[model samples]
Target: MLIGDVARRSGVSTRMLRHYDALGLVRPTGRTVGGYREYSAEDVRRIFHVESLRSLGLSLKQIARALEDPAFTPSELVSDLIRWTEDRLEREQELLGRLRTVDASAPTGWQDVLRIVELLQGLASTSAARRQQAVLAQAEGVPVPAELLAGAVLSESDPNVAGALRWALARAGGDGVAALTAGLRSEELDVRRRAVGALARMPEAPGAAAALADALGDPDPTVRRHAALALGGRGVTAAVPTLVAMVVEGSHDVDAAEVLGTLSQDPDTEDRITTALADELAAPTADSATRIRLTQALVELPGTTAQEVLRRLAHDEDRAVALVASAFLGLIREQPPEDGHDERP
Candidate 1:
């Protein structure tokens, strides 16, 4: 293609083409005998790339280096572009947040411009405030006051919504219990589990124990697990006998044991877990991960049982168990001069 055609196709002016040639930014293929520049198809491609970088807010000098660098791989250049975009976005968000603050304080005449500026500012922000705003908005079921929720993060909520629900369940009386019972009959397992567990937490919930027993028949493992746990947490003696039976024969033996163990301060769960672990260890085969988990759980228990097991596992023939036990023991020990027990065999 000729220089005129290249300029027309690339949208670069003729003067800029000459300047690019001078700067070695983009050059023509060759010159005719009359000395007029001629650009081949490759020249047109180069002009569009330079134009794209300029659109990204890259300086002419930076774009020149990027275009000229021989060692720059496509992936490396793309990664650099991503980092540049993220940095630009962060700066933009900070400006937007400031603009939001400014907008709330602006006089009537400046309000329209401030709104436009705030809208534009997010192009640079991290979008963190937007996430916080959405979460707060969800919690309130309405728009959260930006001034009060400013800089509030996702960590400020969630993970605790269910916990607060439990508190409500703990205090609700007859009518609340009835509503929760109806929730379990609803098709949604999430609604069922959340309501049931909260209902079971209250000491005086009407038929809560019966509702929970029915939930134990629910196909969902989570609903069964939470129901059993809530009953255990409340130490409702009515469920302990059933839990003891499950500890012996149910597929959810471990889940039941775990709930019981957590409720150990109020009920006798450790003995049941100990017996189950002993039975599992007696079997010719057990999943190694399960054994590992059981070992760690036992080690966490205080008193003679934990200490004796720690001593046994500390020198076990299995390399993984021995290494873990040795590492744990080393943390609370003092080196015995040059001959401490840490010495290699």
Candidate 2:
């Protein structure tokens, strides 16, 4: 086949074929009567081979080396192609995500588009200070979209930046909640924790509250504690058991106790709160230290039931638990009964 015939048959442009010949890659095996380049069947096959390699993301030079150099093993070249493809794919995916975030923002003009892009870039910045400033700029009336803030919140490792992201999301209102909910379902433990933490700080809208309620069942203890504490403060008695468990485990037990105390203001939940603490205290598996923390938590609960439980714990078998419970009971007794109701009603 002549160069024109080869171009027509193989879909390789004639100009590209000439470039291939000039580069000494797939030169024709013969010349026609008019001195036009003519390709033998073997040369045509080599041309197809070159195109095949190019399709696999091989540089033309790499393709020439692979075809000409007997020692040029394909293993290393293939690995390099894979790495390059992966890097390109990652860049494309990141660009697509940015575009989607911008589209979600529904920017009205180039200025709005630029502001959103800059905020998105800032949120993804290496410096925590920059990320925090991006979030705070929203407070200063920058139009950072809620979806971007939610994404930042989920991925932010720095505590301060994460807090600012959550604050910005809260102000952004319900738009961030959907992204946060998706983060809650992420298999990554840290992402789930961050999602729950952000949701916990948000206003107790039905969506956020529901997401946090689901997070109460998260496998991570940090996630569960954050969710449970937030729910408890919102008067969700479902968090009472987890809050009591927190006291037993001595993980954020003080904050857990305070939320529990706040939940106990309702007459219906006060007994349940007392019972949860009593059960943890009486559990056979609870060690001395666990029992002591549980005793301290009981002090946060009001009502005669907690007092009665504390009175029994004050003379318990463990010396440390007994001494702590006795001290707590003494303080409860010394404080006027009216003081308890004064704080509640």
Candidate 3:
């Protein structure tokens, strides 16, 4: 086969075949009457082999060694190719993600695109300060896409940057809820925690409450606690059990108690919240410290049941718990009853 026939058959262009010949990668072993380059069957086969290796991201120099060097083993080279391809793929994926994010923002012009790209780069910067600055810039009229903020918030490890990202997401309104909701299902514990935390800050965001409610059942105790607290503050009674557990476990017990207090303000949840606390206090597993925390939590609740629970606790077995409960009971008595219900014991 001549060069043109070889190029046509092998899909390697004639110019590329000539370049290969120049580089001594694949030299045709025959000549025609006009002294034009001619390829033997084996030469054509070698051309196909070179093209095959090229498709695997091998440079021409590496291809030359692969084809001609008898001492060259492919195992290490193939491994290297695999790693290189993986790296390239990762870069391409990141670029594709950035492009998608920019597109989602619906930039009005080249300047908007440039600004969005710069902001994205800032968010992805290794420096936490840069990431924070990027997040804060959104508040200055950058019009950052919510999904971008949601993505940044999920991966941010820096507490300061994470807070800024959450604030930006909240400012962006409910649009970021979907991305944060998807983050709730992430297998990574930190991601789930971050997602719940961001969602917690956006209580008024549509679907944010439901996402937090779902997080209440998360396997991670931190995630569940955050979710429970957020939902409790939103007056979601579903957080009652977790809030009671928080008091019993002494994990964010004070904050949990406060939310429970707020939740109990509603007449419908007052009994349920107070009952959950009283039951935890009565549990045999309740230690002195746990009992004390529970007593303090009960003080945050309104209604006669909580007051009665506190009065009973004032004479409990644990001296420390009894002291705390007695003090709370005195305060409860001095205060007026809530909503015309007599809290006096």
Candidate 4:
């Protein structure tokens, strides 16, 4: 079929199809005389597989390599993936811990974070070693080389960290990931997390996503959270389904739901996130705090889908859940009860 037809049938975009082609991810089986792409049924299924893995956090290059080698073993991929996964989890845990502490009525300060941010901002403007050290001391416990630290906050380019990352990418290109990816995993857990954070700036790699996926299975909850965050940065829609599933299994439901929200750009993907949230509401599996958090996320969605789902949950035996759902229905529709109106027989 043509690109539009394939997009309608497969739920993948035409632009992505071309990207897959460039990466040898999904090449058309044949070409039309007019030079348009052509695909077979098998090609469509392959696209689904590509979509699934991309969702699972594999990169295009890794996807290409995996396709070339059919005997691919998950065990070999899982090991290195786990190492970096721990790093990511530890860092997100630190940030989350601080946030939770602040969120709780605990007397605390973001003064530390603000200080760190200010110091990094100072060093990041220009390359001055003495000034960088002064800033580093003030921002103690802040990762050194504030430039890279800055980029770790995002997956995009920053003048602060670009030079070193270029050298790292070059070294990885020449010596391969064994020397770079593998060694970084051995650093202190926080440093490792920062390294995974660095993956934000670099281009996607098949293994990086896979590694992030494996990290989702880490024994620690915080590690899994960071893994989810890292996956969001590099992953495609393929990560959506898994992310939805994770929402149910997550020990930290609020965090999981928030992570899923980031992937809700596409309708199909957004539907999945909403559906998962609905499923949780319907089941009453989440605690009160979790349900509240989930409901807030539902309200934040772009449509009435979540509200509709809550109405369905009104059938539940748990009066609290049903009552909550009913209350949500009233709020979502932006109405209040009428005095003796008798709207319902």
Please say which candidate is ahead in TM-score: 1 or 2.
Answer: 2
Against the true structure, candidate 2 reaches a TM-score of 0.85
- Candidate 2 segments whose C-alpha is farther than 4 A from its true place: 139-142, 284-296, 299-302, 310-345
Q: Candidate 2 lDDT, tens digit per residue, 1-345? A: 888899999999999999999999989999988999999999999999999999999989999999989999999989988999999999999999999888887778998888888888787789989988877875366556788788888888999988877777887788888989999999998899899988888847549999998988888889999999889988898898899888988999999989888988876798988988888877889999898888888788777788888889878989898899888877766776664553311
Candidates in order: C-alpha RMSD to true structure:
19.2, 3.6, 2.2, 27.1
**Backbone N/Cα/C clashes per model:** 5, 0, 0, 7
User: TM-scores across all candidates?
Assistant: 0.37, 0.85, 0.92, 0.38
lDDT of 1 by residue, 1-345 (tens): 677877787888988888888988888889988888988777788888889988876767777888888775557666777898999899898777666655643435665454434433432245546433333233232222233121221112333444543443343244355556667776876677666656556635667777787776777766666666667666654455445445444446566555555644432455554545545544556455444555554443333444456567677666676677666556434434345465322
Cα error, candidate 2, residue 249 (Å): 2.8
Q: In candidate 4, what are the lDDT values of residues 274-309, reduced to their tens digit?
A: 877777655645776556556656654554566566
Q: Model 3, 61-80: lDDT tens per residue?
A: 99999877899999999999
Worst ten in a row by lDDT for model 2? 336-345
**Models ranked on lDDT:** 3, 2, 1, 4
Task: Score residue 99 of candidate 2 by CA lDDT.
Answer: 94
How far out, in Å, is residue 288 in model 3? 2.4
lDDT at 36 for candidate 1? 87
Residue 22 CA displacement from its true place in model 3, Å: 1.6
Off by over 4 Å in 4: 1-180, 183-194, 197-214, 217-219, 233-235, 241-259, 281-289, 335-345
Best-matching candidate per TM-score: 3
Q: Which has the higher TM-score value, candidate number 2 or candidate number 3?
A: 3
Candidate 4 clashes between residue pairs 3 or more apart in a chain or in different chains: 55-238, 55-239, 57-209, 59-206, 87-193, 89-223, 155-200
Stretches of candidate 3 exceeding 4 Å from the true structure: 266-268, 338-345
